[model samples]
Target chain A: MSFLPQLAFVLILGVAGYILSKRIKFLRRNIFLGKAETRNDHTDDRWKTMALVAFGQQKMFKRIIPALLHLLIYVGFVVINLEVLEFILDGILGTHRLFAPFLGGVYTAAMNMFEFLAVAVLFSCVVFLTRRYVTKVERFQKPEMKGWPALDATLILVIEIILMIAVLTMNATDQILAERGADHYLALGPLFFSGLIRPLFEGMSLEALHFIERFAWWFHIVGILAFAVYVTYSKHLHIFLAFPNTWYSNLKPKGEMVNMPEVTNEVNMMLGIPTEAASNPSAEIGRFGAKDINDLSWINVMNAYSCTECGRCTSECPANLTGKKLSPRKIMMDVRDRAEEVGKSIDAGGPGLEDGKSLLGDYITKEELNACTSCNACVEACPVNIDPLSIILQMRRYVAMEESGTPAQWNAMFQNMETSFSPWKFSPSDRFNWAEKVKEEEM
Target chain B: MSENYKVPTMAEMAGKGETPEVLFWVGCAGSFDERYKAVTQAFVKILNKVGVSFAVLGPEEACTGDPARRAGNEFLFQMQAVANIQVMNGYEVKKVVTACPHCFNTIKNEYPALGGNYEVIHHSQFLQQLINEGKVTLKGGGEFKGKKITFHDSCYLGRANNVYEAPREVIKALDVELVEMKRCKTKGLCCGAGGAQMFKEPEPGKKDINVERTEEALATGATTIAVGCPFCLTMMTDGVKNKEREADVKVYDLAEMIAKDMGI
Candidate 1:
């Protein structure tokens, strides 16, 4: 019987691991579908950024209430998972409380800590779910968040609450079995949170208690494995991506835009200066900017995947506030959706690059791309450092260069800039005409 | 205009075998916009009164290509930037000062990567330094003493560059009660003229961003609205005009207010 249980545990764990690995591989391939760029500079700053932004949740504290509750769940989720190691060991060895003898007092202490965290996690999830459903935070109710995004957030919270409950139930039953002097059970002091609910299992027979304990144990591990797999498909992927995302976040002055080396080289050649060695000399130059996901840089694609869909960017966007079609959060979501669509199509033996539609017309509209002010508000407001403006600018570049779809007035100004080196339709010699006017005013 | 106050150009200064302490970058708006020309003159008067040796690029100075770049015309932007950079490099220009946030941002942040490096200072920061160094003195605040003056932050100058306090300190020196709009500093709203919006008509919308921002300024009940950027000056002026508040509320650049306070 023990052998059969061990075999079942191995098979289940193996299947979950295999499926999760496959999903992760698919996601990795999808994110790397874009052009390559190096983001590995500034090693010390990257580590510090990852620590403070992702690990320490530094940016989340800008709004204090949500930050506190999030911190509770974050700490609970990370710390409680430490108990999973013992579960795996118990399953594989068919031994109960496998670490009890070795850890002694430490085992009880750890159990107490885990129980406390489990209760906190459960409490935090309930509050989070209530906030999403009842309070309807304005950021959560935007038009883009009306359907699956809303359901995804609620579902994650429910899963967390269920997992925490399972943990507490397992602890509660384990305490009852200890009291009954069940075989292979050790007497440890009552776990802090589980001790309170242990009375519900009072006067239960040893067989009944063991059965309940075994069910809860198996359910907790299985639920965790399932949650692990579900995370890759959910916005909660931020849990894993946030570190690298924040690490690779733009560190330059907010006003300093990324200059295209191709443009620089062309300018240098036109100016009769020796051009720098081009990265891909023979590559097509007509595609000035991104029209599809593959045209974007790898970091841009990674940004799409790392988005938490929290709508904080949209909430802070001036364009969105002033009734423009542009929503920075929506830009990220659309990119991820397009990438996923492409990934699935390729997996289904369809031509990947031959997809009829693109991220430009299919997902985001020209009206939305043109509406951005490039003010960096959305960039500043993003807790995870997603650069929606970068994507917007790239699409705008496509519109301007490839399609020649810029507004007519902008074209006139571009002509002015080309001729007089100013946005005004005047000669460069008249640039200092105002200085003479200043003298006239003084007279 | 005093003929005694000679504004030397880089070419004229070079012909005389001289290099001034700074190159005054008079941007397109400062050079052409009728109302903003006063701001340019006011800033020049302050520099003259302070006895700072500065030369203007005059006709040789091109636009910093900020608008072109923001409008996604990279080829035009690079061409303009390279032309200006070449001219500046020819004169061996070491330091530059501009009253325009657009120019300041481009020169200070964007120019170096393309190989044009200079110690670029905005007029507000430079004026504050002049005041601190006992070069420019206010005549007992003159018309500005105890006046409720509110400052409108240009997005480029404030959020983009993290320059929040320098302009405020310049205003505080005039002994005026500097009030703040609801969205000031890092959270300040755009003046509806950034990102090349000044050159084109606004998108179809129920309200203008500048009108909304100006309403916030009007709500503060400030008698004078001080701006640091010429783009903000134009937008806020239009905004005030739109609300028919022109008779009650007036907008002036910080340099204008300072020049007035100093009786320059």
Candidate 2:
């Protein structure tokens, strides 16, 4: 009978791992679907950034209430998972409290800590749910968050609450078993948080308590596995991606934009400046800028995947604050959604399915993209260093170069810049007139 | 020409086989806009008073194409950038200073990638260094003393290049009260002239960003609204006009303010 339970646990673990790995693999491939560009400079800076931003949750601390609550759940998630190792071993060996003998009295201390975290996790989840549903935070209620985004956030919090409850109930039942001195039940001290709830089953028979304990164990482990699989598809992917995303963040000065080498080379050639031959001789002169996911840099796609949909970027955006349609959070979400659609189509059709729709027009309107001031506020506000401005600039480049659809006034400015080498209509020769005038004024 | 008032060009200086200490990049507004021309003259007067050997690029100077690049016309931007680069390189120019944040930003940050590298400094920063070095001294109690002066942070200067202190430091040197707008420094709002918006009409909105920013300045009860960039000077001045507070509030660049205080 013990052998059967162990075998079943092993089988379930196998299936969950397989499904989770498959989803991870799909996500990895989808992110790399964009064109390759290097963001690998400043290795030392990247490491420091990852440590500060992701591990330290430095940016999240800007809002203290949410930060403390998030830290509680985050610390609980990380530290409590260490206990999962013991659970895994106990499942495989058909034993209860397998680490108890090895740990001596420390086992009780460890269990106490885990129990505390479980309670904290449960508390944080409830507060998060209240903030989402009851408080109805403005960032969480934007139009882009109406459907799956809203449901996804609620579901994750619910899952966390359920998992925490299972942990507490399991401990409570195990304590009852230990008191009864039942077979395979070690008589350990009562856990701090769980001990309080242990009296609920005061009059239950040993057999009934044993059944309840077993059910609690199964529910906790199964729910965790399901959550593991579900999180790969949710914005909670930030739990894993945040580390890498923060590590690969742009480390240069915020004002400096990424220059397209192809455009640079073309300009160098046009100016009759002798340029080196093209690196990829076979590569044709392609469209000037990004029209879809594949045209964007891999880092941009990674940014999409790493989005927590927090809307902090949107809230901080001056354009969005001023009632423009350009929400930086929605820009990231649309990219992720488009990437998912393209990834799914490719998976279904052997990587050759042509989706006629694109990120522009069908999803993000030109008005939304044009409304951006390139202010770098979004980039600054992202808890994970996602550069929404880069994506905005790329799409604007497409509108300008491929579609020739810039506003008429902007086009006029461009024409003046080309002819007179200035945005003004005057000749370059007239530029010095102000200097002489300044001299004449001084005289 | 009077040695005290003459502004030499790169071509004139180069003809004498002499390179000035810095190249004064008189930007489009400082070179053309009538109001900004007074700002340019004030800055020039200060430079001359300080005996700094700075030469203007004059006709050789072209727009840095910051407006073009920001407007998503990369081709035009590059063409303009390359043309200016060629002129600067031909002049064998080294250090450059500009009173315009837009030009300062594009050259200091963007020009490097296109093979135009120089020790570029905004005029406010240069003026701060001059004051620190005691090159220019204020004539005591010159007009601005005991006046309520509030500084507007230019988007390119304050947020883009991290140049908040230099201008404020310059203002504080006049021994005048330097008040801050509610949204000053890093959290400063754009004066709405950035990103080529100065060259084009603003998109339809409930209120202009400059107007909103100007209201913040007005609420400070400042007699003088100090600025560092010519763009911010124009926008804030226009904002004051819109509120009919032009007589009550005057917008002056940091350079212009110092020149006035120096009795230039």
Candidate 3:
């Protein structure tokens, strides 16, 4: 096949994919992390985190052996993709068969290597499917998927299964045909598929099987590329987007609490947990932080995108598991669903967050935010390293600093800390009593 | 080369004429809040046994503002931080030691951001050094040979500052049979007492975090539970008592355990 036509198809599709991504408005905001110290920025210590977390997928399989199965499937898919080009070139121009005519042995050897890789990938996907269904790792086992998203995941699995099987069948046919010819010592086609098609082709002569080869070649090449485009817009976009997201992670401060904007007009500002972001939209209008999804800083929204939906954050969250209102899964899904629902409006590119339905107003609650232990287990579990602690801290700051709305326990703790310089409600002057013990020891 | 050790907090020096080589900054929990005050004082007692003289920074010492900062009140944290810095600068003290892991981590990692630069050491590390230097005798804890004991890694001490070995070394030196909780080091579960949750009541749950951990210790069939942080000891003891599992496990601070064996 001449390089011109396939190259043209690639460029056209690439542009369409790029433009459609924008039109669909799926990706929003780059460098979308907060201006804080995150581990990603401190790459000097952990260069491997980039590879392991970003590529090796340390986050996907929380469980060891099952995760390994998932890893094999993940790696297999990535490794075999390079072969699609050769299949395309062979199909369009009929210039290359299983091997190059000019350099028969070398070309045939390369095909043999790639053919084996394809087989491995096929086996991997089958095991991964089995793991997803049978001995399912709960994190990957999402039964709650509804509407198009649910269907999309299934379609993806089906496509991969079909591609792998077709490649195997085609390669089998090639191996059988190779046995007939001396130059065919290298190509292993005329494979398992050849026998099935053989009787039919034999009735029409080997010429018909040659015709069958042309169809298989075309089918594998075009089908994979279209699938690639489909993935760009699909939930599976993490296959590509996750790496870049992890690289540019927030790398925010480990313990620095988010500062709430202080209130100067103490009297006019609502006194207790200003649950709403009073919107007078004027330049100096006082509002609670994060009125809506768009109101969330670019990094927070990026967190929603950066999520692999691994469920690590949600699964470990004490609030969610204990049957509380919050689930990091629900939180992220809420953002994703809300974003897709309001895409065109956002694409209109008017004021962001100023207009959309408020995120906190609709989904989150004071109890849910307060229930967080700030334990950072969710942060630790996240493969991409998004920090739920930071978000909770921000909301906490809004409640304490701006609204001064805290439960009586917090009120009492503060009173104790203020008087005694400690929160234990103990005598302040006794702060140094331990020193007497140290002195007695010396004597 | 790093000169990363804590400088004496101002509260340590009052009318004291000269700078001291080490300023022991006993945290509130170590001083007035818990009986574990002996951890720092007895540690100094041991240091004196090794002929290492240290100054105590008592009255001038105040909260490290960890509670306020963690509870999301930045203004209160800054206020306490400013006051603590002033007390430290007044002393011209050089080195600081604190028994509390919370104070150690906040002083070592966070204080510099607000301009409180100090060289800080946890007494556990300092005491271990004293032992290594042959400054103090390890005459402590009558051989706890038959009793299996579990060690709880304090969050701030182990994960925050990466000081995993000192307390464990102390336990090993006692010749006690050591049993480790499933989650001992970095992966150790929080005692449900961090983020200033200690002073504040916990959200209602079926069981307290401390009791949950105490049950973990009892499951190991350990007769005693040892802890480095005073907060952990207090909470875990309460947890054991609450579960009525105190008969199975007695919680002790590494300091009290060592002092008993040292015959101090």
Candidate 4:
């Protein structure tokens, strides 16, 4: 009968692991759906970026209050998970507090530390919940955050609170069971926070106490497993993706937009410049710019998945502040949504990219793309270096190059640039007319 | 203006088998915009005062293709880029200085792939360098002294290229009180002229971006709104006009301020 519980624990873990791996594979496939672009140069610099931006959470300090609150949760999330290893071993072996007898005083100290972090996580989650629901922080209340995004954020916080409660409940009951000399419950020193809550379980029967301890332990571990699987589907994926995303961040000057080598080759041909000796005459030409998820670079798609919906990009956007239709946060969310849609359809053996819908027209509108000033404010504001402007520029390229659908004013400017080498119709011969004014001042 | 303040062309110098130390890339705005022409002249005046050998491209110069590239017309952008590269490479042009952030950014960062590479410096950074070298001397408490001035960060120069301190340093050299906008440096608001927005009307919005940015600048209570790019010069100038604060609040580029401070 004891073996039956171990078997059940093993089975549950196996199922959770299987589901988590499947979801990870799905994400990898979807991310690779984008065109390949090299981001591996400067390996040393990439590592430093990952360390400072992702691991160190350096950019979060831009807003001091939230940075402090978020640091508590981030540190607590990492530190508390160290206790999960013991939980896993205990469940597999059908032993309670597996490390208590082996490590002696160290086990008590570790539990105390974990308990401290659990309380901190709980406190931070409550403050965050209030900030989201009560105060309604402006960034969290944007239009893109109205539906499932809002619900997902609330669900993560609520789930975290319940998990923290489960940890404390289990600790308190186990402490009571140990004091009562129950089997398999080691008498570790008091966990300060959970000790305060031991009064609730003090009057229970030994058997009942044991059962409640077992129940809370199972709930805490199982909830963690479920949460791990759920993160892949939520904006909470930033918990995992932020590292890789920052590692591959664009390192060039923010003013430098990506150049099109294909366009360079075409222009070279047009200008009668000698092509590279290795240039192939029969090379296939790809679409000019991003029209769908597949058209963007893999890093761009990963950027979409890595978005935490903080709405920092949108809040900082000049266009968004001026009441324009361009919300950079919405652009990222749309790309992620379209990616999910395409990934699921392909998984179900349905038509994928041929679904006759695209990220450009169906998900994001031309008006949104047109409203971007390409100012890089959104890029600067992203904590994880998400480049919504790059996606905006790519879609603009599709509208201009593929559809030739730039606005009338832009078309006029383009014509002027072509005919007179200026956005206006001024003659090149008169380029130095301003100098005449300087000479007249001299006279 | 001194008779020595002559803007020599690259062709004029190249015809005599001579090359200036730096090629002054007079961007389309600097060459044509009536308001920005003064900026071009002021920078020229400072360069002359510093005794820097600089030459303009004159009739041979073409657009740096920044607007077309930002507007998503890559074909046109590259055509212009290739044409300009051919002309510059023919002259063995090695160093370039420009007053426009857009042109500076495009030529410095984007042109290398198209076989055009030159040491490019924005006029703000160049001005700061001149000040550092003790070449461009400033009078104590010159025209801008005791008057409050706020330097607006052009997007291309500030966030794009991370040239935040140069313009501010140049302004500080005039012995003026430099007040910063609430949003300055990395967090500075755009003047709404980047990405070819200067060439087209903005999409329908509750307010124009420049007016919104100008409100922040005005809130600083600075009498002079200093700028670094010609696009910023036009946008902020119009913004001051929109608020009808033109008489009380004047917008000048960094070069113009230096020129005034030096009595050039």
When only chain A is evaluated, what TM-score does every model earn?
0.95, 0.96, 0.71, 0.98
Residue by residue across A1-443, what tens digits does model 4's lDDT show? Answer: 77998999999999999999999999999999999999899999999999999999988888888888889899989998888998899789988777788899999999999999899999999999999999989989888899899999999999999999999999999888888888777888878999999888889998898888888999999999999999999999999999999999999999898998888888888888889832676467889988999999999999999999999889989999999988999999999999999999999998988899999999999888888888888999898999999999888888899999999999998998898898888987898888876766551
Cα lDDT tens digits, model 4, B9-47, are 988998898899999999999988989999999999888
The segments of candidate 4 whose C-alpha lies over 4 angstroms from its true place after superposition are: A277-279
**CA lDDT of each prediction against the hidden true structure:** 0.86, 0.84, 0.62, 0.91
- Ten-residue stretch with the least lDDT total in model 3 chain A: A264-273
- TM-score of the second chain in candidate 2: 0.97
| Order by TM-score, highest first | 4, 1, 2, 3
Candidate 3 docks with a DockQ of 0.29
TM-score of chain A of 4: 0.98
What does candidate 1's lDDT look like per residue over A195-253, in tens digits?
88888888788888898888889989999999999999988899889888999988777
Indicate the residue-level lDDT of A188 in model 3: 37
**How well does candidate 1 score on lDDT at residue A400?**
85
Query: Which one wins by lDDT: 3 or 4?
Result: 4
Candidates in descending lDDT order? 4, 1, 2, 3
Locate the minimum summed-lDDT window of 10 residues in model 3 chain B.
B1-10
DockQ for every model, please: 0.58, 0.54, 0.29, 0.73
TM-score of each candidate's B chain against the true B chain: 0.97, 0.97, 0.88, 0.98
Task: Give the alpha carbon lDDT tens digit for every residue of B113-207 in model 2.
Answer: 88899999999999999999999877649888888899988878876788889998899899989888766786677777877778877765567
Candidate 2: deviation at residue B188, Å? 2.7
Clashes of 3: 39
TM-score of each: 0.95, 0.94, 0.80, 0.98
Candidate 4 positional error at A156, Å: 0.4
True-contact fraction per candidate equals: 0.54, 0.42, 0.27, 0.70
Model 2 residue pairs with clashes: none
